[model samples]
Target chain A: MSATLAVAAAQAKTKTSNYARIYWPFVVPAGLLVFAIIIAPWVFTLIMSVHEWKVGEDPAFVGLENYIRLFNDSRFQWAILRTVYFTTLAVLFPMVLGIAAAVCFHKNFPFRGLARTIFILPMMATPVAVALVWTMMFHPQLGVLNYLLTSIGLPASEWSYNAVSVIPTLVLVETWQWTPLVMLIVLGGLASLPQDPYEAAKLDGASSWQMFRHITLPLVWPHIIVALVIRTIDALKAFDTIFVISNGGPGTASETLNIFLYQTAFAYYNMGYASAITVVFFILIMLVSLVLFSARQKTTFQ
Target chain B: MKMRGLPGKIGFALSVFALISPAILVFLWMLSLAFKNEVDNTAFPPVFIPNPPTLDNFRAVFEKNNFFHYAWNSIIVSFTATGLALLLGVPAGFGIAKSKASKAAALIMIARVTPGLSYLIPLFLIFQWLGLTGTLTPIIITHLVITVPIVVWVMIGFFEGLPAELEEAALVDGATIWQAFRFVALPLARPGVTVAMILSFIFSWNNFIFGVVLAGRTTRTLPVAVYNVLTFEQISWGPLAAAALLVTAPVLLLTLLMQKEIVAGLTAGGVKGG
Candidate 1:
């Protein structure tokens, strides 16, 4: 009621008053929607994490047992380690390839725009769709990949089907899809870069490679960092490709944290345990994001 | 980022082709698979292009599945969600920009930055309780979790870039705050609106996780439909690639055509709305 009166007063005063006074009217809907969808679910996850809950039954209070069990669960531990491993592999290829692509594209060229437009097609393609296409291509016997391998005098190996190779194989798919995204971001940075330093380096008779290493690399470092941060966050939350490709694999080999939490809740119906995983996983992501965000703040985008 | 002369041009061309071929090869492979018969798809050396190209796979995609219904569902859910996001998000973005509310902007960031699965289970349960599962409503509403942030953040950038003097002049003309915003600020942010709409629509259309969890069979969106095609007992590469291609066709065309706008939106948002 008081809020209603305030809104009315703000409206009446709107003709002569400050615009900032009406902040709530503009801000609150998005806030409320976010709260209802993201925040409320988050709080509910917190509550559910502490209880022994499953589908078709009431949640029983379990306190720290779920968290304790999660720590002791070797599979959960493996998921964490595997998630980190996957994130590293996923980010590394994309970063190196993307940066190289950006640098290569940064030079003057014909059909540059058309080539770039084609390059980013993989990134823009639907993730699930991309996974499916790659899954066919990854088939051991009938697939193009093995055919190509034999053509090149290499042995055909089971790709995502092999437990040991699942994560790396999935990372290959990920790199295929997202390297273009990193290229695009880095290219944007490369485009905006001031030319004066390069001119100075040229005047000083610096070699091309030296100009790149000393001049170009330093200026574009911030953009590279931004791409790293973005890719890190993205790679950590990766699901669609991994899910469709391995479905956590021949065993639990490719089951990253996201997949683990998902199966725990949906497949196993261990809601409380899944919720516990959710909290831990969410916190883990938040911590990584926070670290990157702070690092980003120190670099750029402030 | 520009260069001169023949050597530089040749070096650039080689690098560009080497960098770009992986992407082109995969897409071309998908196209080939979509056109090939199942026998040819599994042939020892994969056919680079289908010799007798067939529309049979495309036919199977439409016939074996309710593809058009799912496409319609995708359209309805994304359109409604993107519309609602714009309605709520633009003003919030403007307010956040004008008020210098980094916390609020960060709050929206928190919504999107969290993993989708973290919220999916609970939202699924809530929707079940509300008896809104098996419908488009939940999918549309839940998509706002991600879409609103994209719109709000992108629009905030656009609003920040708009000249303040234009709005100040409107204010000085005895225009109300609402008038100044509706007449002066919003019109100038047209490009931002387009970016927001294209981005939100594309993301919502392509969203797999939310559609997987919340949507029923009839209500399944394109990604979910394509996923269902994959789970069928025998793996038919022809039908599978065809389904995937059909699902991605609209978004791909949009991205290919509006390359500049998408690039601007991407660099500004600095996050994957794809």
Candidate 2:
């Protein structure tokens, strides 16, 4: 055993040395591409954020003025508020619906595969197309949504047009498009869960809800947190659906940080100010992600 | 609350359908819109199905704009990006898997998480400086920001799932490292390759922001075409929905066909990220 272990150790050393030469070649191409394409530009964004730059003018260094200006920019402030509101609300429905659906599909049931296949389609379809479809459905007079509402003995209001109801309306669309993704993530966890604990709980005469609430939910907490992190990030980054549907419409009522940043950079030609927003955006994402990660770690080890 | 036997089965199926029907109903509505005429499209008591369904809306979208041209640009950009991503990503995945290269993996994941707008700003200026704006080249290159990481990350999952003994056995049989990867690992990863290829293609095809920032009038992709139809032309629901469907139909079909693999691919990233 000792001799074999020594041979294995020697083999590992040689293999690692070979890797030192070979691995760099294999990794460098992809590394260089990502660095050149993503990382380098990100660094440039940081640099550009500090400079007073605009189109057709030479850039002059402006220190922390742009960053400081962001605090006083009301539109940017509203954009941040709208973004938080959108992400928080958008993530809730999908988690609840997705978990319920996952629970439904977790056990053996008739036509479960077919049901899941149908359920997953919405998340798979193109976002742009999904946006347009929902936009047409949200139409006030000729929309199917209003038709369905009135058929149910409920009054119909302007869907995306009403500033008061716009975020909820958009959240409905978001939930429609993304609940399947959450279901997909959670279903993966459900499929792999051990049956032993479930059987033990059943032996104790635990009710189904009790079994789920105690055994299943604890085991699935990590997976749920993963879904939460991904959903939060995607929700924060949401652009295509909003861009196509409202274009941040109804008088900046729905304009999120992404829209504000885009307009500041491209429309208003305030590159420096936009870059400052980008930096803050990055910081916000990192902080939220760190919190989520630490939470996931706690749940996973427990 | 447990309904045993037949009633329970029925209830489960009913609940599933209730949860899923919104997506189905909306799709049916989209199809109805795409097949209706302008009069019936805007008609109150909105036509659930077009009476005497017309192909004129599809024809109008195709004729009024160069739909095929935009589709061509989409095909070119996605094909180049996905193909390049695969070529670069597979070996990178293998190397990272074997080396336990966590930093490399994290580096690639940055491209995945960084907002496209951040890259859009500087790359737009850089492409302009290089005089490469208004062409397909920049669009294809920028799409790498989406494709390469997807390919690398997905492929890493596949390669890592593979047992090390297979490669060791090949090496024992007098195969070189290159031959072992080529003969043993590559063949085993064919399914992973297929998933990565399809996903990268579909995502690149679906991308709108890059094309919006980079493409000239004649160089736009299909999603942009859908947007232009909404903005530049009249809001004829029939033609608008038709363009939207045409843009998504290919990917939607592929997703339906490969639901299981796609789910696995998507969740693998999430699990690994966790």
- Encode model 1's per-residue lDDT on A35-108: one tens digit a residue: 89888999999999999988889989999999999999999999999999999999999999999989877776
Candidate 2: tens digits of C-alpha lDDT, residues A13-129: 887787556556677788889888898899999999999989668889999999999999888889999999999999999999999988887767666777777887787788889
C-alpha displacement of B256 in model 2, angstroms? 1.6
- Candidate 2 achieves a global lDDT of 0.84
C-alpha lDDT values of all predictions: 0.86, 0.84
lDDT of 1 at B252: 93
Residue pairs in clash, model 1: none
Q: Which residue pairs collide, candidate 2? A: none
lDDT of 1 by residue, B1-274 (tens): 4456889778777778888888888888889999988888878767777989999999987887788888899889899999999999999999888877888888887766678888888988898888998888998888887789999999999999998999899988999778988999999999999998888888887789888777786888889888875567447789999999888888899999998888888877775642
TM-score for candidate 1, residues paired by index: 0.94
